[model samples]
Target: MIEVQHLTKRYGPFTAVDDVSFKVEPGEILGFLGPNGAGKTTTMRVLTGYMPPTGGKAIVAGFDVFEQPIEAKRRIGYLPETPPLYPDMTVRDYLTFVAKIKGVPRADRKARLDSVMERTRISDMATRHCGKLSKGYRQRVGLAQAILHNPDVLVLDEPTAGLDPKQIIQTRELIKELAGSHTIILSTHILPEVSQTCQRVVIINKGKVVAVDTPDNLTARIRGSETMYVQVDASGADAQGALSQVPGVRQIAVTETRGSVTGFEIDSEPGRDVRRELASAIVTRGWGLLELRPMRMSLEDVFLQLTTQDAAEPEVAHE
Candidate 1:
């Protein structure tokens, strides 16, 4: 588990991370997202013991990162934006060196190294010098090293960077598999990846925590109303008027039309369900109920809404 309390980082007159705070539960994959220059890297650096914060505190795996740097670092596996690879060493030798430094038992080093390299899809490149590897291979090598020791937490900054689409998929699956054993903080600019991979999200802006919640909760909080998409086949009959009569239906507009079938976007009062009423009305009128489903806001929409607004007190989600 990891906790950050009022963590702040400053450089002379500039504050890179300001009073930021959040937590990653044991075995949870938390997505760390922000626009460029939003202090994502700065915060990650402090969390990984790459640098000390100006104020506040960070704890990793039961050890205060600042107070017990050695113990905390021992439990954390970090893959920074750029893979730290030695130019002259082959991938096997490089990982072997890292294994020793990270305290991988000498007896199990070979098996661990082989498993990590294979899982990261870099087994074929084991004999290749790290510096000679293509960007993708280097990134894979970086990932292999991070998990070689199977630390308690993984702090990955763009772990999928430089990977091809297939490689990206593989990495995503691997990260998902690592959950329940490794508490992960995945910081990336890829929105879709966060939505698919992270259990919760922490969106940062201007060095401050802007939002913290599950993706679903953030979408619901930002949307402010319930929206539904409905399609009806009534041969151009005014289905909108019929739909408007349903209780809790606040607004309606046609979104598409194809012959006798028509699609409608409906807005309902918050916490209300109008599907039953809408469906009955359509059936009673003998109009074909083609399609009907809730239209939740996309993660991108939520991200844009939160980041574009003036920084507000972070909307934290609780069970």
Candidate 2:
């Protein structure tokens, strides 16, 4: 539903977004991730036709964003980091105004408004002034306005920012519900939010696309060694010796507790399953196997490794 090829945006001598390219398929939720000053918002603005790119082309829903901006924008719904809101207007009035500007038909505007308000759970605040609502409610109102026109593509920048935990969960669910019918590009700093809500992720650093893949695949790619945490009722030295007997185990470090139980982490060969073998070794050595489990890598680690790895390489100056 969205395609960008060699898109670059510059402000004088500084390149805010540098030769970035990617595709978002229909019904796919593509998570756009990066640290501050990574040009994420600039890219989003270019895609939404709010700003034109200095180089390359972007097409959304079959229309080139630069050559056919009106057509491209007609199919897109965009919500910036701080929602474009009118504080003086009530929720109902604001949404109605947006619907009119978005060219919603007079006959369908009311229905669209109702559907969006219900979907975003802002129906209760319909009559309340936008400025009077809490941050969470105001966010819901912003979401309601964005989708009120029912565009085929949704571009959301930090949609859940500033919301409480409960509100964040609710917003995540709402985004998931909208995924199948809408091609979405979600930009957020919350790694877990992307891991939970998006089918694929694109990691950008310093204005360039560094990594793009499914979350599980990206995690697997960066994982160098498998880890196993084991606890046994024995001396640390004895536990380490027992673990060494397991095939595929590369390294082990054990520490003793007050009750004669030993805690150890065993580094295994990549892609190896050492839990079963470790358990058997503990049993054979006459030590009680208190716990044995494979360690899982967190999304944060994967994100940092990929972004930092790219940044460490020296940049080749582009004319």
For model 1, what is the alpha-carbon lDDT of residue 218?
A: 82
Q: In candidate 2, where is summed lDDT lowest over 10 consecutive residues?
A: 310-319
lDDT of 1 by residue, 51-167 (tens): 999999999999999999999988999999999999999999999999999998999999999899889989999999999999999988998888999999999999998899998
The lDDT, on a scale of 0 to 1, for candidate 1 is 0.91
Q: What is residue 306's positional error in candidate 1, in angstroms?
A: 1.9
Clashing pairs in 1: none
* Cα RMSD, each candidate: 2.8, 3.6
Candidate 2 has what TM-score? Answer: 0.91
